[model samples]
Target: MRRKEKLVTVQLTGLTHKGESVGRTEEGVVVFVQGGVPGDKAIVSLARKRKGVWNGFVKEILTESQNRVIPVCQHFNYCGGCSWQNLSYPAQLALKEKVVIDSLTRIAKVSVNSLEPILACNQEYYYRNKLEFTFSNRRWLLPEELQNDVIDVNKNALGFHRPGTFDKIVDISQCHLQIDLSNQIRNSLKNYCLSNNLSFYDVKNHVGFLRNLIIKTNENEQALVLISFSEDNQSEIQSIFSFLKNNFPQICSAYYAINTKKNDSWFDLQCIKVYGEDYLLTNLHHAKYCIGPKSFFQTNRLQAEQLYALVKKYAEFQGHENVYDLYCGVGSIGIYLADQVKNVIGIEEIPEAIDDAKINAKLNNLTNCSFLTGDVKALLNDELKSKFGAPDVVIVDPPRVGIHPDVIAEIINFAPMKIIYVSCNPSTAARDFALFDEAYQIERLRPVDMFPMTNHIELVSILIRR
Candidate 1:
């Protein structure tokens, strides 16, 4: 198909799941424009066309929407971190609620009994407890910099990857996502590397010493810094680790890993502790958690507490009810509800997460929680149920793609009294819920804005067997 080069004016009516603004051409063709707000008239340049849908970029804002607002971040436009930052928080919440409703009704063809008001974040910016920045040799240049006669700019960047560009990174001066300590740690490391002539990772060529930096903070103000390097340079690693440890007394734990692999996945890779304890301590409600470098905790700490509260509410766990937490990462949800239920059985695929789950259960001194490591689809069978006893309530917190078909089949076979589903992706949740509509009736749904100023929203659903 020939690419559409002509610029077309569109009246954006809504926002898409990927944070793009939705509009239709005069002929009824759908167009998704990036950085376009709803209820705005924009001139968009079409970038790609496929199957009656056109993807484009906003070329000119002919009429601004009432929902539009000036973004606080200077890197809002070029950096893909916060696409909905231009829209007001209330507008963002409304659009997200609409997205969930559309996904449930239109995609899944399921009716919801009730939807509670979206739980908004108390603090919007800097609500994220974790942030990971990439080290790239070729930084993405802005439009003005590209047009400059003298193209003199620092090529080394330690920030997020540009949207739709894997090899290119945006040089961030200040990121509004995480706490102020994150910015300080990132900037100090970047400056130290640049001044010491340390190499940044060349994503295309796959060569460099510095690869990625990850910073995680908990509710208690304890921080953990993890540095991933492509090559093992002990001297350089020790120097940087020591520098961060001495400079930032708030960093309770410091770890480093040598990841020579093609991808940035270091979960399976061994992480060497360079300073302090091997794990950072965090508490939610009354339960304590030990967070390792590879641990899976919710990014938004404050909202996570709210999300877990909703999960607990939907589960409706009585003191004698046995609860099954499926796809339980680190047993956060199960452990949170351990005290309320008779016994909590947590199942996860990753062994490391299961390990963390066990540690967390011990840390909380809960003897009723049992965490098993295996695929939910394979492990959730009649034999497993016989061994673990039938669950009175089942709480599932699946990944973005939602639950597997086989897992759904297993869940149906188990047929717990109540099923509480926690989903990060609404479309997949809707689809999965549709499958359960045959045997279960939807009772209540609560949407939580765990990530503010972003298109992503978390949802909790309650289902009772019909």
Candidate 2:
């Protein structure tokens, strides 16, 4: 019960976000054990206590799980990239499906029969189209096994921060979860920064030049954006830019934004153009989408196409029904389904994404599609209903936090014939779905593996009138 005192043998039921096992004691104390799979009997060492939950590491695995497999990635546990690498791909998919079903039934008051089969992705690895890495001032020190022979922590720039330790960063050469271009950009930037004597950002002090690097590739275009804390010397930055342009000509657009904030997120920052063009263009089938540094796009490109296709299929538009797209980032879903419907209206909170969405609509000559910029809850209220009229079909694709209760109430109040809910977080979606349990009957649910290696998965559910 006490920290570091109880060396108990517990069975790991499942894995958590930190690649730890989900186990519970007889007295209902939750046990989170590191490096143990489901059905494994693990001897754990208690690490800390937080809000009554016990965190620990697996000192020994007394019995192995039948489903456990050898992790494929060389930097599996240390890299903080793939949490479910130890789990077989099939098992991972199965558990994700179960998580969706359980979340809906338990939290949303929906039946199992209402859910549909998960659309399994053909390719699991190297499906990512975008990868972002922060350059850390301090390199992560190796364990005692290789401590003496490790690289100097002060001199080298680290690639990604390790889990639960913001101060420590692991210098990575490659990540198999992303395509080849992602690794190339990360590795190249690290080398460039090192050679140029550009300082990497220190999380503790919040100082340095090379802050964050974001690489995005599309069917026809690729973009690399570097955000720095401060631009002390413009000529030096230009030299770096020239080298990048010469080396990676495929990068049509390269930019650098100046953000002097303490937070890692760039939601609010005055971005300045440092090089090349302004935006990155991505072609999705027949449609084209413009991506800004602040705009939101699905990280997994191939699976996103499938996700949009599934959403379109569920919409069942007859070129007459008017559609409403909630949380439409860059209007990817709205634009994709625009031709099928008479008119599509997209509502988003961020003004920047809405601007990109407008540009995308104009680029595609989608006169039928229109976008409004405002918060979801406020936009879906009386103002939206008065302006656009009630839609025939409503498509809601909220963030990981899920749809707010007020927005859910608005959806229920408006009462569209068909409701298509797309969610990245099943737990929150299920919670939000419960609010409309009385009026709408769960028609079908499909899970899409947007992120293959990690524990995260996307679920799309369609609800019909009872």
Which has the greatest lDDT? 1
Clash pairs of candidate 1?
none
**Which pairs of residues collide in model 2?**
none
User: What lDDT does model 1 reach?
Assistant: 0.89
Give one digit per residue, the lDDT tens place, for model 1 in 1-466.
5554689888899887789899976667789998889988988899877576899988999999999999999998788899999999999999888888888889888765577888898998999888889999989988788757446777999999898888999998899998888899899989989999999999888998999899998877778999999978899999998888888898999999999999998876898899888898887777788889999888887788888888887776669998999999999999999999899999999999999999999988999999999988888999988998998898999999899998888888888999999999999999999888889888999899999988998998899999
Candidates' C-alpha lDDT: 0.89, 0.79
Return the top candidate by TM-score.
1
- State TM-scores per candidate: 0.95, 0.92
After superposition, which runs of candidate 1 have C-alpha atoms over 4 Å from their true positions?
Answer: 1-6, 25-29, 50-52
Q: Any idea what lDDT model 2 has?
A: 0.79
Off by over 4 Å in 2: 1-8, 17-19, 24-30, 145-155
